[model samples]
Target chain A: MSLAELIEQRRFVGREFLVWLWFESELFEGRFSLDALGACELWLEGQITLVQEKEQSRLKGAAPSSAPEAHEALRQGKLPSQARVRVTRGELEYAFLFNADAFALAGVKIPSVVKDAADEQFYERMYLIEELETLFTALYGEFLALRLSAAWETGVAPFVRAWVRGEPVDVAAYQKLRGKLAPVRGAARSRTTPPPAQAPERAARVVA
Target chain B: MGALKGSISFSKFYVRGELPDGFRDRFAERIQLRAFRPLTVEEDAEQRAGWCSIENPLDCELDHGKIFFNSYLNLGLRTDRWQVPSALFKAHFAEAEREHLAKRGREKLGRREKEELRAVVSRKLRAQLMPVMKVVDLSWNLEAGVVRFWNQSPRAHEGLAELFEDTFELDLVPESPYTAARELGLTSEQLAAFEVLKPTVFHAESTLGGAR
Candidate 1:
């Protein structure tokens, strides 16, 4: 097939990836450990755009990574084309608007600034940008791990399928993993504080 | 913000296919800088286009043990008749018709005469109009097949991809989530599953759905 045709054929995959990300964040609160990618934290932050071409409607929601409305739209066959997300690893945090169709990043905010080191600032900035790219690469690597795993067809696919259809998902084993990943709800949990509740239908509350 | 100061926006592509022998030499031939040339706008045509690299080797630098290469592709276009006012054309055509009628003793200029006049006017107008130039930056990792273009325009992306293929005979695939996953080394079974992969929905109640 021609290159354009090939790219068009893979468009759905990009949309699915966004959906997977939404599922991962809402279900596990953005905590996952993969043998290949190790422990990584991701959260959908700021604005998100979900497009449903057949319906000719674009649904948008902002902040609180767990937006139920966004999930609702996804359940209704809408897929995210763009999202503002925050990714954290160790002491570094990178926030950017990610475009699913183009796999592009814009308005990226790198981790804490390197203070007053004029001559070193240039190199430091480059280092941080490269680091962010590496993190993105690794995240994709993790997705590939789960996506290609045998469990995907045997179980995970069906699990995600059911969730996408607005059906209840209570597979106990995944729940145990989530529970283990969930932060303890007191003083020790401030770091993983649930995003503040939003408007009634739009609220992205992470149900414990 | 861009990968560096003063730069903004970029689109990502995953490089596929092996670089042929003497890749650098071949790449240099394709990306060598050229003097700016004006686009040749055909009469009555809406626009004409041509493109070339803005700089040779673009830029190469090393930072923290990694090498980065950047290049830019510039596309230029010229309009033939867009800026010429219809009134001016009408006036010119009227004068041309009058001259034709007087010379040939005919009441009106023939279709050929009118066409000829239009061509003249179009050419004149095109000479007065300036060409528009668009620049898209390319960032490549010397070791990895990662290419980040500083523009998301579909036309620009396709153009750059075509240029790269022509230059290095390598294909550029968009690292869409699925393609990326497949490239990460898939087994036969996984490949089969991927072929039939379907979009999954996320339900609020399904937070614990994958535990089994």
Candidate 2:
């Protein structure tokens, strides 16, 4: 496919990534251990927009994604188009509206200013923003790894389906599957590596 | 507020192609050439967009100091458009049409006459009003080959891409799922998977009440 056609057709990838993020945030109770950042926290908070073409649900509050209406919208073939996400790692915290289709960041509230000088502050700001991007991309990399593997169909998809239905997820099975799905070391977390041959037992424990 | 300070909002793009040697000097020279030129009644162009000072939009004399900040190159994309409000234009057009008809001793005007009168009305209004001005900041990290534009609208994206390519002679790939994934070092196979994967229906395949 042409580059433009490829990009246009894969817009759903980002939307699904948002879904996976929502499900995983609930599964891990807002904490994630990453290869680069070690331990970090991320959650869907504030405004949430679930949309399917002309139909859309806008929920607002501290934890909008947890609302019943949000899930109902998801159950009706709607996906999160944009969301207000808060991410924290160690002492640093950043919050912004993530546009799923475009991978754009808006209303980004970075961590507090530490440097007072003009140029220094700009550098510091850019550093914090890039730090957030790195953290976010690392999380997305994990999702992409699971997404491209057979494990998505055999392991993650079932758990995600159960979670969206508001049904309880089995914890042990999911942890085991996640363990096996971890990106192999010294290689990219993409289609570069051979796909896993099979999926072991899988389960998911939803915090929501 | 822009990349320099305050809260941030931006659309990211990946820069393609290698910068030639002496790019800094070359970029400074081109920035001045593309600097915003004020709108005038004589000009038929309704809108014009070009580079300006990120600190001061009115400072169109772009130079090395204003265009570069350490490893980053920063400038403002300023666009000015001449527009007469539809209601005011209609009212002025009707008045002008009536006056023209009275002077010509005619009850009705031909299509060409009306068109000419409309142009005349626009010119008269242009003399009374200034063009609408908008400025958006653009910051490019030369080392990273990434650009963050302050505006996220499609029009702004097009403007940035067109102006950037025209000025720097480089293509810019706007950050999308595919582009962002590629930037993450996705393998060729992984990138191809982008086209194969389909949207997951989640629980929608089995609706609780009925088909939605």
Question: What class would a CAPRI assessor give candidate 2's docking?
Answer: acceptable
Question: Each candidate's DockQ score against the native complex?
Answer: 0.18, 0.25
**lDDT tens digits, residue span A56-99, model 1:** 23444556335667667766767788888788877788888888
**Model 2 Cα lDDT, one tens digit per residue, B1-212:** 58878669999988999998999999999888999999998777899999998878998987777777766788999999998999999999999988999998999999998888878889999999999999998989887888989888998899899999999999998888777777777666666665688777786443222112
Which residue pairs come into collision in candidate 1?
A: A163-B201, A164-B201, A164-B202, A173-B211, A174-B211
Kindly report which residue pairs in candidate 2 clash with one another.
Answer: A173-A203, A174-A203
Task: Note the chain A TM-score of all models in turn.
Answer: 0.70, 0.86
Best by DockQ: 2
